[model samples]
Target: MTGGSPGRQDIGPVRQSVDGSTLSTSLEAAAARLRRRFGGRLLEEAVFRGELTYVVAPSDWLRVLAYCRSAPALSFDRLDCLMGDHLPERAERPFEVVAHLTSHTHGHRLRVKTALAEGESLPTVTGLWPSAGFDERETWEMYGIAFEGHPDLRRLLTTEDFEGYPLRKDFPLQGTVGGRIRIDLRGKI
Candidate 1:
């Protein structure tokens, strides 16, 4: 299992007995199970380019995350990281949330990504994984994505009085007041 970066390889498909029939496969199978259990809400499946990622609708994110953690084959117990992405021009959902999950026992990793439109909110997964608290908060502070169930949802990396999300693709790189290049020239000549 691999996450985030390209070149990560998933373990080859393996056979496993679910019932009377022997239906065995790779991460694709796991993704199928999730989709079947969750219905047609899943957006993208088997999208294992840079990482073994499953993109779900923002509304189904909480359920999907829980299923990934409890699913027999894809037992992702560790929450490695959670990040946010900004895609301004995308007609669909603009903000993307990526969660990296790892199973130490199985030596496998899985990435779950969900897209939320502007002003939309995603359910928090901190109930399943305590480490998600800080990660989700940071994502909210940086990308303006809100985690509905986060206990202490607040700005993490930015000041409380910060005006806008600094990481959104639409957010200007330069300051609004002066339109000046906000470059750090402290050590550069």
Candidate 2:
């Protein structure tokens, strides 16, 4: 990754050239380039609460992550975290998987989020970042999301006997109640 201003550890923004081409000014520029390349499929492109976040379609997730790693200005060599959120009640997309990417060399951070419909499986990134294994496992166990090509996909935090997904909105919070009991009144009377 290209070094930018002093104290700016990670990728920052990039500037435009006189020929109407874009140039890397900082890490933000790298993200902008990704947005330009993906176009309408790119959902969110702003830094949220101090983290660079990019939400894209599930089909384009792998390509987007690959681009982020390949782009010189934003070489996020590490997959910091990968997790999924359950939003079954939403009228639109009901599920989302969030991947956090970071570059120790550039000291930059980027978040990639992909939306998936019910029962959809997301492409595995473990091949690209081995650290994603545990994260993917946790997501799968909690959200019932399948990461295609994951080496050992299994329940991480839950027991093997557990039946339904605990994190999904549709999952019932409590098990069925058996029956009601009548209180004895002869002793009190």
Candidate 3:
């Protein structure tokens, strides 16, 4: 009932910092800092099972993430995961690339994701976090998403002759391009 807003009403007395200034939870503060820094580019916010997720637009993906890695308040220096997913249910925007970031300095975790419309590609984060090299390559091969400036994006798991993106939701269950195994006719079986 104190310090409320029109869209998001405050629940109770806002927590106070040691200096007696009103404060929000650390995660809430992080979200607010990102919101201030990104404005509309930071698209949506979701908290599921106590985990914070920030969905940014693909247009500003690289800039926002770079800010996260460098900003003093945010400093999301470690890139834990950079992967892609196909969500047919989303319909309009079916492809999504998610990055998990951790701030060892502040002991905070954030999940950042950007939705892509099937054929679109995201900018490479290898320059920001060199550890993302392998994950970006794998995501590129599996989801058919290219990291625009990746240094050495080659096949990580599948072969060069692989026809389709195996990790896509629409990919065949058994196999697509690879030769099928004849279990019954094979003498080894």
Best by lDDT: 3
TM-score of 2: 0.74
**Distance (Å) between predicted and true CA of 147, model 2?**
0.8
- Residue 80 CA error for candidate 1 (Å)? 1.1
Best by TM-score: 3
Cα lDDT tens digits for candidate 3, 34-88: 7666665655655654456767778878998899899999889899999999898
- Candidate 3, overall lDDT? 0.76
Across 105-157, the per-residue lDDT of candidate 1 in tens digits comes to: 55666788877788898888998898999998889888888889689997666
Assess candidate 1 and give its TM-score to the true structure: 0.73
Off by over 4 Å in 1: 1-29, 47-51, 176-189
By TM-score, the better pick of 1 and 3 is 3
C-alpha lDDT score of every prediction, in listed order: 0.70, 0.71, 0.76
Q: What clash count does candidate 2 reach?
A: 15
| Pairs of residues at least 3 apart in sequence or in different chains that clash in candidate 3 | none
What RMSD, rounded to one decimal, does every model reach?
Answer: 10.0, 13.3, 9.1
TM-score to true structure, per model: 0.73, 0.74, 0.79
